[model samples]
Target: MTFRSPFAIPRQLLTGTTSLGGRSAISTRLRCNQRGLATVVPPVTQDATGSKGPTAMVFMNMGGPSTTDEVEDFLSRLFADGDLIPLGRLQSYLGPLIARRRTSKIQKQYADIGGGSPIRKWSEYQCAEMCKLLDKMSPETAPHKPYVAFRYAAPLTETMYEQLFADGFGKGKGGRAVAFTQYPQYSCSTTGSSLNELWKWRNRLEGKRANGGSEPAGTIQWSVIDRWPSHSGLVEAFAQNIEAQLKTYPEEKRDEVVLLFSAHSLPMSVVNRGDPYPAEVAATVHAVMQRLRFKNPYRLCWQSQVGPSAWLGAQTSDTVQEYVKRGQTDLILVPIAFTSDHIETLYELDQEVIHEANNPGVKRAESLNGNPVFIQALADIAHDHLQKGELCSRQMTLRCQGCTSERCLGQKKFFAGQEQASMVI
Candidate 1:
């Protein structure tokens, strides 16, 4: 059962395609590229003996609860993170209090959207499709097996690591593992936290081995997909999806339609500390707008600001109301920061903000969940890492440089070492 806005207008009206003669934005944009979308990708060659052991691509993200009962637990775990809350000594005491207070309200919101977040389902599907694409792209390497590791919920990062070790992943023998951060934009709080948990598990395993525990299979050489906010395949996916949504609007009003790009908000405190999230999110919007050739006037906004310590702004809901006040009735919301449909897109944007705005034209574009182009983008990233034998992007050989954030810096150095070791072999 899916949850759609009860106040949502008819399909045609919502799409802005009345009986008025108007060309669908999708048809107009995609007419030339009907065969397949063009993307900037590195050449993939069929080279055997790339790596010896099985290749594991583990996708990591901030997970949601699978059921209503898990809501409080999810919130508690999320709030308990010092990276997210940053309450220091007060966090252990206040995290549970905050989660307890917010649980019921958040639970109701989740119920409004079919009783749970569909993030895991969509994430798993994306991973599965990416595996297929990776196999096709790099026939020389062992077929990639996809795994999901959530930071704060079931199938947690530790659980996934244990499973991989049990299955002989990372047990040397030339086994290669890729920790792909699902967050296209890098942030100290999100990707940083997930990777830290992952390495902690690795260190624990080494400790066990040192203490006379039986050594498992071979050691696994690990790489990472740190950030790809503006990868060509990813940009194409967003542009195509936005154009498709725009086709629903009346052709005459399409030129005046406003594209509102909303991303999850981080506290200004985080930004003051030099967290790169806001800048990276803006880069994504800039890239997508460039891809669309700036067809529509757009604004980048923030959503889901929690715990109210002066998060990023102007807030999405307030922006919607302000646009209406300015006689801008035709608006389309693009969740630029989020890759899949979840509470932020489903409830916060769809149900609360749009519903409260009371404007029929203020509709939302769907998230890029399991889009084939996006899957290809992910596969391309992994294939590049495997071929180069380094954790890097097409944009850079080392994406994080001169970085003060300990986790980000450490991970980059670790991958740089891996690249050096590969050269020695």
Candidate 2:
């Protein structure tokens, strides 16, 4: 599948700069414009006495459409991502066709969920709030700027990269930026694809020197918070939400209410590739269960498996149906993997599964959207990463056991080597 940029660059931005792989020259200009453009665009960094920041905290995720009108484009982009869907050699040909075919159905789903996904609203609010807390928690990284890089919607990775350049990041005046994945657990199809796209843009916009040396001096240095499946703050947030949901049950039946932790399912193809998602997701469930002291019976189930391919399951919908049929109708579904409300939770879980079960006792736990605890956890994670000064988690340096993609290898190497690169400067 091919990821084509939906936004175009003005001709002026392409004046005098190198292009990578004959792609475009605009990206290079965005970096090297320091020579003449620095005068017009003031740097975002602080003066000698202030905090060492204006740090960019970019949140990455697989975004959904914000409105019904955007559903088609969103699905088209999603289906076109080989990293996420992997449609083989005809990926380019089949992706758009499949997207067009499914657009109407998906659009209706989004319409039923209040005309669109609340992901963008929640994501923006969460990131902005997290940045506010970071400014107080980590003075060294104060003036934290929040940027959302959505894989399949508006404010795409390319757009975010351009904004960074426009905001005085990489025009030869080096600064720091952190790519924080919104997903609690890492998966090649999700976090990995986002990082790969980020890496691609970094190379295009901040490519090697015209003389074929290293990257230009003062280009933005990057670090990553790749994954944090079982962070204490995260577990606490989930446990609290589950407890609150449980309180709704009758006093006598509270303990009998089943806690079903649901995460997006992966294609078995991906799972067999040794993707770390399933295991990490389970880690999060275990951590939250321990925090709750396992007061209620619980199980992990997968949801949102698209297409006909074999997917990892105990499919959430099926599980809910079976349990309710067996008279275990007091089930509280916890969207464990998603950070905010989207079509999956709003439409699938709420509108479809629970609605079909036709039982008022069957309900869903609240998402982490705008949850103070979850937002605090975000700040804590960022603060720790900034203080530790690691390029990325040690786990990020390793690839899946069955991986063979050159893109994955290169992306890993670039991020993993940032420690030495940052040190050299």
Candidate 3:
């Protein structure tokens, strides 16, 4: 959760930088020892001018452990975040104790999924695929280099930024940077935390450079894709995934299969503070349901509740039990919030939740892991946003009126400022 380094280094450190090659050098200099992950050195490809394109696409999300030994560290880092646990000034003191207490249980869960989460692999693949798709679908940004940064694990945000800065990011020659949150729905605890961490790091580098330090001085044009809960392409992807999963049941039983949309739960304390996560989640579910022309019974439930605090619910387990009691045993549980297959989807839904259900007919939809349709949807969303060069379409950019978190509010103002800057130019 914490790293120590000065904000600036020598100008020679960044001279003659290229995309994948620059990253390999930075990784070597840092001596990255993350779960055997080496720098992904991409082959050189350039435009007609023989120069890499100016645009870079960065994807941000919560990272998972690649092995059993890292489970404790991942959870500890997650709990240590004040945005997640809200332990006030005592977070530093109590977070470690809490993580240690839960390690054994969480480790067991990770073991069920091959001793670690495959999230890193899946995310990296998604990044690589997106790079190819964007080049083909949005050639204006061709020669795009992709980077993935995690909030709680390796390939940490600061290191990814160092690679970008090395490649002349935020420098005029680099052209532009577009950051897209992998979380479909926005939450102060997740995407907000990642963005805040990024800016904090970027600011430190910039402040030091402004005072005649070594960080790159020319600023890159930056944009963000903050939230897209109801994006048409995304909605269609979910609808298609759910419909495909439901077809596994017999035709007659299919009508009886309840569509259970489940998302990771948030503490009510965060909700009462006007985080807007719950509402955004609902928006995604509603949009997906509408896309399916869903007439069958459906309900939104929460999963992955940790610690004994009130969480956003109708918990997924309790709901299944209640449905079983009512003799509605047929079900299709869709992980509406998650895009990748991780512990929450693989272990929680497949094993723990299913074990609690008395209905043998209950089934779950697979997470959208490397689905070509879904990946194309992601590409389409980014292509459109980049073409317009806006944070989002005005409709897609709407915020929760009740959200009062400074981070959420700041995102709104930041995008508005970008639009105004465009006007002045």
Candidate 4:
């Protein structure tokens, strides 16, 4: 019966563990810990009073649909970010307009999944499942501290912090926090956004007279696994989910069916800007493809495009149409964009794209809902990170080299002070 903030971000705490390996460029250059694998996070130590702060986890995500007459207003805020969106000025006027126009359709789609999105509900489930799995997978830390912070929606960064503060949770016992991101992959937009928000929140907190955040409360000891796209257990979970979903399909048609892997669309601009989201999707798609016993080949596509700017690849809508034209009656759409079935998966795949190229065979593969395998994978990934100590290896961040984003709490700083001086004013 506890209510928490919708906004949650990752806090970088000094990991007490070591990082290992030097394979992927992302992992090699910037690991959760620069040294080696194997982090040593001290078990949660309880104190004298009745207040024992819990170990917390926050999932940084592109949140589900906002339930507001002002849903358009929410969309505008997303598209209006000067750094993320190319059309900031236009977004001020056009964002809400476009979002409002699409509201009914989107709203109806949400209705299909119930009155609201299943993200928070699923996340909470996953949290409980994660705890269960952790208890089984890593008995040493039987019940880890975890929390969810949605980027948008009612629970926001400001609100989560308020709850945390009121709960007697002040970064660690005295002043440190072992923060984690649920996503196994690290991309500028995904991992990066989470990191950025954390910094912003920390800075915002530092500015408040109520909580002087300047001093190290528990060093925001940052340990993030980033993205576990390559994790074998997770890949296996996908294989299992895909297998279970295909149950309704005729066994012989499995080969005939096309596996469409659809991820949330990112701006090609992020790639241009050095965010590795596309690569992350590529890795997930490839890994899943390898794991599936697909007699039928698959295609990797992107969907749910926002903003007026050019996005990364073939839109899911177009893909659907093309698949229909190609005479493929059966198709399975896999949304690896999110681990669970949220608004994007519900509305975009279930509603918008479903109608695009209506075919008798089109169906979306279920997202990773607390399925036992997938849930187990979550714990395995966490265990792996704990084994490796640090979540990522550090590489030189050009943005952070000389940047001065006081509120930017990322270990890999993106803005050099020199670059922001002109913008800071």
> Which lDDT tens digits does candidate 4 get at residues 1-425?
00011111112211112111111111111111122342332345545354323344554554565353434444444443434443434445543444455566555655666766666566656755676566656654444654555554434445555444443445443422334455555555555555666556655654322232244444233444456676787788777777877887888777777888887666775666566567767888788877775456888887766534577778777887877887886888888767788666765677667755566578887778767788777777766655555534332233432334453333343221222223321
lDDT, model 4: 0.56
Instruction: Please report how far candidate 4 places residue 140 from its true position, in Å.
Output: 4.4
In model 2, what is the error at residue 352, expressed in angstroms?
0.4
The RMSD of every model to the true structure, in order and in angstroms, is 12.7, 8.7, 9.6, 12.4
* Better model by TM-score: candidate 1 vs candidate 4: 1
Off by over 4 Å in 3: 1-39, 43-52, 168-173, 208-216, 391-425
Task: Give the top-scoring candidate (lDDT).
Answer: 2
Residue 327, candidate 4: Cα error in Å is 1.3
TM-score for each predicted model, relative to the true structure: 0.81, 0.87, 0.82, 0.74
Worst 10 residues of 1 by lDDT: 23-32
In TM-score terms, candidate 1 sits at: 0.81
Which ranking of candidates, highest lDDT first? 2, 1, 3, 4
Off by over 4 Å in 4: 1-54, 65-73, 89-109, 139-143, 175-178, 182-184, 206-220, 391-425
Off by over 4 Å in 1: 1-53, 171-174, 208-217, 392-412, 418-425
Tens digits of lDDT, candidate 3, 1-425: 00000111122221211111011123511221234355553433223364336567878899888787886677667766766556555555555655676677777777877988888777777766777888988776776777778877667777777777665565334356777889988887887778777666666554423332233545555577877888887787788888888888888887778999999888898788667678889999998888778766899998766544577888887888888889888888999988899877787788767767846788888788878878887888788877886754353244444555565455444444444423211
Model 3: weakest 10-residue lDDT segment is: 1-10
Ranking by TM-score: 2, 3, 1, 4
The TM-score, computed over Cα atoms with residue i paired to residue i, of candidate 4 is 0.74
